[model samples]
Target: MRFANQTATFGVAALLAAQPAMADVTPQQVWDDLDAYLQSFGYEVSATESMAGDTLTVSDLSLRLAIPDANGGLSMAMEQMTFTDTGDGSVRVDLPQSIPISVDVAPEDEESMQMVIDHGLEGFSMLVSGSPGDMTYDYEATRMTLALGSLTVDGEDIPRSAARATLSAGPVDGETQVTVTGEQRHIVQTASLGELAYDIFGRDPEVDGDSENSGMFKGSMSGFAIESDSTVPMGLDTSDMPALLEAGFSVSGRMSYDASESQFSGTEDGKATTGESSSEGGSFEFALSPDGVRYATSAQALNISMTTPEFPFPLSAEMDEMGLSFSAPLSKSDEPQDFSLGLTLAGFTTSDMIWNIFDPGQVLPRDPATIALDLTGKATPYIDFLDPEQVETLEGGDTKPGELNALTLENLQVKAVGAEITGSGAFTFDNSDLETFDGMPAPSGAIDLTVAGANGLIDRLVEMGFIPEEQAMGTRMMMSMFGVPGSEPDTMTSKIEVRENGQVFANGQRIK
Candidate 1:
């Protein structure tokens, strides 16, 4: 009997999750124990579910109160609901197509009230069909409604009133449909729209079994919009808080993996902000290999015409492309083992920029010119399972013996504000001194850069107030004697070697 009750009551959630039914479960048992479960929750059953062939139908039931959804308490009075339990081990429920809640708060209580829900679930049907692992319930519906009034948790009036929300989700293996909705009807408050969430999913069959124990996953979103300007954060306490993807959003993407390698790829497009400047466009891709992971990103034709409190003015431009790629060896312990890095930029030029994107503090000068860079480096590990002097035994993987050294080449280039140069150098040491700082060694590397054009650039800087008149004259003197940044000061040249020990020279002429 206890087993029958447990299996019967769990049918709803089981149907939702589509739990397998090939074990010990049956339809007669569902009907025999379902009403008892409903009655246990204090629901006065007005009628028993009728039967049509293999389906059990329960209509004209009043949900006086449900297990207090999330926010606690039930508000609607005569909302009709229906449930159908198919004799073939399946169940379904039809809820109000649209449910809008109205809050009647006095002006005095308005400040105490945070938000109100207006329009909500109109109707939905759930299906508990299929085996245990595949059992699922589906729901669907049109638009929902909502309304709200301004209130404050700490003390403030809201700006807008009333909101409406509705949700819907897929064809689950040709088994179930799910839909949810919310809105504000007559409530005159700023926070009207109530609990809202939406989501969608597609099978990733390609993730068949290429990689080891891990599988690859990828996805994309055309867009998603979240609007809860007046809702109070405190009103969320229930466990079944809809879903992230279930909200108003769109996307598509893919990914896959094998024991040693994996990859993910996708793009996103949608309104980031509101007003005359709201626009969006961005994409990202990533891949993993024995060497580590690599990724690229870009934001095209995005609207920079945003005017925030910091800018105080309209800012605009296009981030043609900017990206970075790096990979690191799996960790040997609590500490990281090996590492590598690389970065790049193309058509990445900003215009009328009030603040610098790289440095939000506005410490560096903004550039109106093009930019580019190429860099790569790596770091070795310390622990050697090959050598057993480390410890008695290891846990996850292996343990480091005494200490480790990072053999690295911190090479890089830049076309940054006030400078354009390239250099190659290393700062990480391999296995040098191991007694000073625990077991980790030092870092060492060198860099060589070239400023292809120096005269025209210096001239431009001098005119732009970056360089003073006296400094410009002194610069000319230095140029004639030595060479410019990349070449001889007088004749335009091509590269400069900057030693790691702090030495600067161009065209064989030592500048520092």
Candidate 2:
């Protein structure tokens, strides 16, 4: 994998650097710029270089990665590579059939360990073309494969393992734009995997000198696809708080998984258990920015079933559909930033074997359930989250300034179990006088809430022996004073308010 990554990075860098103001640029110039760029990022790059007409050949290409506390570094090499100038402001990259990679860790030890890997690909190529300010590259791999060559301990091979994976990403597209007089770089990249499959089979990975192994497990996922697109600020001084805030980078992507199947069986303590899970497709989306972040996920259908001799019944559960959405603000400002979250589950039925023991008669509503909330507030951070010194200040006293301008419950909703509840409210705080509320800032506002089917729910609970008759009677008596009956049947409404003078009221009547 590291070999594949380095190969891709070098190939892309060469092509990107080749984009010139005109089509008269030479191939050698591109490699020169690439070498300089890699050097700036702490990478040692070397290759056998040659030029033939409009083509440049870089054979035996090798790269050494940089690490903090290691005498020896990770390195990889390719047998042969080529970069050709199309003479029309375009460049093409050609790669070899295989690349070898090796890693050495704990080099200080006399008997250090090492691992070797080999990556194989078929029909791997990239084409780069565009103007100077904006460059685009398109690459494709018809078939991609990987193998773990060997892992040696004290310069000796351990128990040989059999593991491999084959992947296919038809084509990937990337675009880079330079702005702010080349001070800032904006990049958008997208790629996808299709018909991706992998399998693993390892037995008794050398437990002791004599090799007494404990357990073994093997599983595989098939018929799933993943696609992603992201946009972010690259090569920025993240330590500079103000510069980071100004950049305000963001990324958004979606993944769609089709009908997929996965199964696993494991043995432990001389016992074997098997579990299988499947999905009928789903989609998830997420986005992040300096100001806020948002995410949404939904699933069409999912099922998990397991069979074991230790259990009397085959345990299984499933959901027809599920959805969730959330958003949070990440900025600090005097004005409040709005935040909201919501969730919904539909047709969430369970297997009969499990439900029969809990609710045989179906006392609960099997319908869809939903909950949502929205809030607006201001947070005063006493220290910069990126400042090392300021972060240390957070260790003492209050992490944030004891200041809140306002808080508003813009919306609140919950609908489940044959009942519905909804409310909304807003409040302003008095930071000038915190003593009035015992060191907490005084707040004044009113919240209007309404509940439907409350009376029916109470009646059902009493009939089910969950609530005693005496207790139900006391609850009804208490509701008679504070709850205002709505026009709808079994419905009630209440208006709760708090005054700056520390007074509490319900339904226009003073409660405290």
Candidate 3:
């Protein structure tokens, strides 16, 4: 969400840079033009301007925008904004502080209740130096905070309460470059929000409907930070993607959310709540470019515990690590691009109470459980995903989404429930004959999969009364029809293939 806001900010700054430069212009005029430019894009700007020698100050400047079909608006307001001529074809910009922001939404029906939110900051200030084409800024604040200001229904306020956030980001810095053409501009920009720490709580609200039964929620995190960079054409419609295709510019970013400590808790009606969760720390990374997009995320030492009045004991579980990563091409072209994805989980364990409820004899392993897949595929898009008209054509079924030329499985593995499974395969598709596969791409290839200790696992389930005798017999018959016994005891293997004649085969026998 922060990344999205930064992208919009860059677009706004670029629009301002494209305006007439200072030569004979006053700082007040610069801000006026900026305000007007923002208005063209559905934003309302309010401010009071004053000039002191060569320094110009804009007080209580606010930028607001209302949501469509909603009876509410969002705004960001500053207390003192100043611009000083540096006498070198540049200006120094300063924001002494910011006022608390308020957001309220009231349904047109006049009966639906809503929340009012307010955010504030302390020791807020910015020092920026730049000319019309290029600008740089460094910002600092002692702390940033937010709260639920109130709750209202039918224009009447109700008693409400919320906990403050212990949020702090030491400092932030950024730079933006604007290239003005006849009437359009190209922009490149980057920004970084330093390490962030937050601890927030949601106190029990004073509501008429449920005064006797209420709950409170609390959460916290530390050592999270984000940085981003992007380049794109400004003042041009991106829906058609003409500018994107011509410029080939893209947005990319890196973030580190490796919080040192994180936790959450809740209570309801003087009893432990039904919803509770916690995590020691986690990290996430993301990036986007013309060639492709990618993301990598992981969390560590996670646990969740919950209960209900109907259950005899609370359910609790823990895991040491969880991770995921994926990458895919962003554009369509004659040449093939690479794509892959993977997931992993380790050191999973459950509480003794949970184990006693089922596997009292401890038939299952107390070790980690894991499942992972890695695949590489090449695709040639029949329609540009970024093009509005082409997208509409595909959405309307006037064309296929794309063509999958080739696919190969690098790895496939799973180890859980007293069994291990693994497989790999390769395939080529026939996009010209989608009808043969019921509107799906036709493929011709083979895949091999093997399961170890399957028979033993089935026997254990039957012994534990998890599967009835009739069901177990049916399962065995189905497996025998499609699988061959492996050399290893209790192991089974199956071979699946798609034939060129549009037929499917299992265990060397035609099934379709």
Please tell me which predicted candidate would have the highest lDDT against the true structure.
3
If scored against the real structure, what TM-score would every candidate get? 0.41, 0.73, 0.74
**Cand. 2 Cα-lDDT:** 0.60
Error of 3 at 139 (Å): 2.2
**Best candidate per TM-score, number?**
3
lDDT of 1 by residue, 1-512 (tens): 12212222222222231233443323433434434433433433454456666455555543323332123222332244444554445555554554433333324323333444443444333444443222233333332333342323334443332122223221111122222123210100111112222321222222323321221122222332111111111122212122111221111121211111112211113112212221244444443222333455544433334433345455555554455555554223444355555555544445534444334544444654444544444444444332233334555456534333443435445565555555554455545654443554533343444554455567666665677989988887766664443334423333455444445556667766
Q: lDDT (0-100) at residue 165 of candidate 1?
A: 24
| Candidate 2 similarity to native, TM-score | 0.73
Between prediction 1 and prediction 3, the one with superior TM-score is 3
Which ten-residue region of model 1 has the weakest summed lDDT?
184-193
Return the candidate ranking by lDDT, descending: 3, 2, 1
Residue 249 displacement in candidate 2 (angstroms):
5.0
Q: For each candidate, how many residue pairs have backbone atoms clashing (under 3 Å)? A: 95, 0, 0
lDDT of 3 by residue, 140-159 (tens): 45655445566666666655
Better of 1 and 2 by lDDT: 2
